[model samples]
Target: MKFIGEFIMLFGIWLLLTWSLAPAQVIAGVVVTLLVTGLAGDIFVFKASRAFNPVRIFWMIVYIPYFLWYVVLANLDVAYRVIHPDLPIRPGIVKIQTSLNTDMAKTFLANSITLTPGTLTVDIKENELYIHWIYVHGKDVKEWSEAIAGRFEPILRRIFE
Candidate 1:
């Protein structure tokens, strides 16, 4: 059951990426997805009970719009900073403790922060994530961390934790 779900999810992603209906392309995608699923089924598929939670799916769906909006905002902020003559950037690394308990949730938070403009995830030690900000907004670690990662963390926690 888990294998089937993984195969379907992988194949769906393959289809979305390939976007070709040709028989040969689909066949190749299915073959590759199947092989990959077979090799990493355990990692790709969650345990039986958690694998197909509708709540997680709902959160995942909700996350997309929020993520896109944040990305756009981040891009605009970076653009403004670049265009401004003063080059308004403080540029410092801040360590923030993540609210998420699971490593996967922490990883998701780190990746999202890295993907956002003006911020880069430098390192992760246990629950602590170090991020370099192009413009330091505040000196308070908790507030800074919340500004950078709080929005995504709760959604990611619901989806992955």
Candidate 2:
């Protein structure tokens, strides 16, 4: 049952990405989807146990604006330095702790931190996240991690495991 559902979801995504409901297109989708399912063979999986949870996942959709706002703020901060002063940049590497228990949540947090300007996730050592911040505003590693964990963890926990 799970296998068929996975294949169907993949097929639907393929159709949406390819944008063709024609017979040949549908056939191609099924073949590709089936091939992926066969290859995955239960290895590739959703962390969340439930098949679906739209209500709980609703917060993720609502979080898009906030995410975008943060991204924009980060970009503006980067742009200001590029355009003004003598490029005041205080480069530093800090170990940030992660509260994300699952791989899915941690991956999302790492990717989110990297995507946000002025900061890049250099490495992840178990529960600790190593980040390279262009400017160490507070000179506090814990504070940076708190900032990340506070803003992103809740949303990821709701969406993923």
| Per-residue lDDT of candidate 1, residues 1-161 (tens digit) | 78877887789899999999999999999899989988888775355456578888888889888888888989999999999999888899988888788766777788889878688999999888899989788768899878888778878988988
- Predicted model with the maximum TM-score: 2
Q: Give the per-residue lDDT of model 2 (tens digit) for 29-114.
A: 88888899898948855533344678656867776787888889889989998998699898888788877787767887888898
Q: Which segments of candidate 1 are over 4 A away from where they belong?
A: 17-23, 42-51
Model 2 residue 134 lDDT score: 87
Residue 39 local lDDT, model 1: 89
lDDT assessment of candidate 2: 0.79
Clashing pairs in 1: none
